[model samples]
Target: MDDPKNARRSDSLDLAYNAALTKLDVATCEAMAVSQAIDVENSELHLGFSVQIFKKLCSHSVALICAVPRSRWVKSEFENWDFACAAGQSRAIIEGFLLFLYLSQTPSCNAEWTAKLLVLYVNDCTRRAKMMANVKAVDAAEDWMRQAEELKDRLKLNPWFLNLDGKTQKRCLAGDHLMISSRDEILELAGWEKAEFYAIWDLLSQYAHVLPMSFTRMEPDGRGSGAANEADADYLTATIAWCADTLHAATNRMTAGFPSTETVRQGLDSKFEPGPKENRP
Candidate 1:
């Protein structure tokens, strides 16, 4: 009854759509398995191994999903593909790699290992700052200083710190004073804060769909300006890069801390927050 050409076209479209959906389904299952593995809370040894397994699963999922036609895949296909899903997958991969590095290199292994790694980065930044200060590289020093300042400001605005309010701010500031006695300490604190801020940013970025994507780089107003200055542009680039890196690292840390399926199920089973009951007669 149908024209031969139209029938062929319809069949082809259905085939493509079905194939894409099947691939997406496989990717979702793989991603969920990986998440479950990461979520298993046990000894660090077990956790670390689980995380490695999870990473392998994620790699496989990414390859499989990517092979499918992008046009056929909806946002939900990628978004709900994993624990954090595709939105946070890139960050999770980077974080897993970092954790792999830390476990292999460091003698001490604990929950705070990631924190220590951040401290090391901070120290490196500080040493560079000092070395630059001694040289006639005023421009370089100023540039570095600007980055540090931006990080500091960002840290202050971090949700974790913001949530603490008056008491936590005072305590944290006091602790900073005591802990940041040396250049190394100062650098470590900067690094730690920067890393924390980055993790928060990555998590929030998952929900960027609800936020405004457009913003003027040159002027405060939404109107498009001619262009931004070279230095300003450079600063923005560096800041964005740093934030990205920090977020990736933090995501990795959080992923490593994820609980297993059994644990999640058990927790859910153990607790129930009841809603308001209807009025009795």
Candidate 2:
């Protein structure tokens, strides 16, 4: 039987989740529009070394926007948990983009950074492929690993791959040395405050991992169903809104000089300069 408290909690959660989805939609649109400025007809966007990174930012943003699940997706008890995990992942992507852009200093992007990014991407692909044990996909991951090395060599990076430790996780080639940065590392790189970042990531991970902390917050009916309370609504709303703000930053860096983003002004500016395409790897 459904308790009044449970019903009230479910209603609140549904409303909050729907509202958050709308905000995510707006953020995605704004970010895409900014990218369009760079991709304008005949304008000839010259992403050069940062092309892959830009593409990743756009794709991840789209993924997050597409992840706004509805009632049908919440049939199971763990449905909300799944959605919450997606939110955390989306948040992490935005953070990575921000830190990478800051580090690239891309007004004059170069091959070294591009090669490094490719290496990181390959490593991530390899890690995921190995984790899942899909034979065909594993072969594809090997190809990506090979391509990553080629990029490193093309960039004249000596001692490209390194395996200091035997453990796959610890193994790193020369390019791997600079590939992906952890969340803490990105925080240091971006020089942004961590209050919001830690709060959002930690709170979301509770649901994503099915921690006892998360369970304590759920209003469970006698049946297997459950609903989160007001705090979930408040925190999720804030988290998604912040994600939109980060997306705006991405668009700003990606299309800094384009006419489309002319009106999109903010205090934070990177030394953004379009680089020549001659050194693309």
Candidate 3:
């Protein structure tokens, strides 16, 4: 015998998904309007290594706007939170990529440095992935080690790359060792200071993870962080508020020339303009 309850549940889920898709379409159109304003073909545009980050930066920005659900019925005791959680994760990544676009303005984002950093990042990530796949993933580990050696050799091209630590810069990255010590150096080369990075982008990272302190902010009553049948209105408003702030920051930082960025951002913000709080069943 087929259960009608299951069918109703499926239908409700489909409705919720479709509502998010509708809102996602609005966000997408807004993002597209902004992207078209750029002239990537102009010879004066110094978007060599930066272009790569540009595409990813846009993707992250788009993902951020798409994760907010638009429909009122998305009210679930807990299910509605899935997208919010994902949005936070995407937010963290977006913050990092925005930093890259900012840095691409400097010599650090040049082909030489980009190549070395890419190798180190990719190889180190793969080695870690393989380590998880197989405990004795020695080959992956060795490959990363070799690339780290090559990257160290290239660092000499930019002698002042490690100006922060001076002569005692104990900087050689080895097996399973990432070139993290040079991160501040790269930021400095991009005319950005470490204090600003820590204050702005780095601190929000805690929200990206399922940390113990995060749980402290949640409540099962649906009135708290989890989900509320009616209180969800508050959460949705808050999410859109976040999207607007980040979008503006990203627009200012990356300069993607999104013509409709301001308009769409304003429109999105309009969705959450202060109104009577709806918290009824």
Candidate 4:
């Protein structure tokens, strides 16, 4: 009776361990599927379409969290949880997406992208200001203003803004009171100290003039811009390369750290023939 009871308990434990492994396998598959889908959809976007795709990618990240197993095993297993990896991956994807969106053709999207970019710039400025304050630099204010001027220039040249010519550019800077006023508003809301505000302003001004022309110079029609097509293809290729490299590194790490399960070891050995052994004296 006691022996039978022990066997039943061992069998139950085995079943539970198998079920946990199956769950992890399923979650990994789901994560791979989502990653592949994002890679495919990323190729379909023109400049302005990235925002939408980024949002979709983030949503998928949330879904990925539910598929991971709940048990605590090793540190690596915790790190490999679908939610943790997805969150980090989503941030990288969003940043790349925004970089592409910054190259869009429409004025409205350009303005929106510019605004978003300013938020990041101002945040950086805030950090710099705190640092300058700590060090008490005498020339901090002057340096900040120069940075702001540079930013202003760059903002004007950003691809979405349609690269205004020399006369128009000067005229817009001088006559566009709304742009000036909006900059003030943004500065106030961003809560940067004086030096930081100058830094952000200069940086944005400089960013305004660098036109983002596509290398491919594709004809503009409903079929999509050639530059965008080429860009998408290049991005997809890079993403696949990254994924492959990551997969290889992960496999190597796992192999080095842990012995393979019996089934996996057998499968691997099945591919090779054993040679006759030589005896040494």
The RMSD of every model to the true structure, in order and in angstroms, is 17.8, 9.8, 11.3, 22.5
Order the candidates by lDDT, highest first — what do you get?
Answer: 2, 3, 1, 4
Candidate 1 lDDT, 222-259, residue by residue in tens: 12221322322222223323323433343344344653
lDDT for position 113 in model 2: 47
TM-scores for all predictions: 0.24, 0.57, 0.53, 0.24
**lDDT by residue (tens digit), candidate 2, 1-281:** 88999788778776767776666555555555444445444532234445446556656766555453442212333434233635555656655675446444542334434444555655564555454456566666666666656654544442332321334324334433444344566676666677866776776667667666666545454111223345545555566666666766666666663555654332122122121122111
Misplaced by over 4 Å in model 1 are 1-3, 37-281
Question: Could you tally the backbone clashes for each prediction?
Answer: 6, 6, 3, 29
RMSD in Å for model 4: 22.5
lDDT of 4 by residue, 79-144 (tens): 222122222442343333333233222335546557335433543554465567678874784475
Residue-level lDDT for 99 in candidate 1? 40
Residue 159 of model 3: what lDDT?
A: 46
lDDT of 3 by residue, 55-114 (tens): 455565455543444433243333444324444634554455444544445444455355
Task: Give the C-alpha miss distance for residue 134 in model 1, angstroms.
Answer: 30
lDDT of 3: 0.46
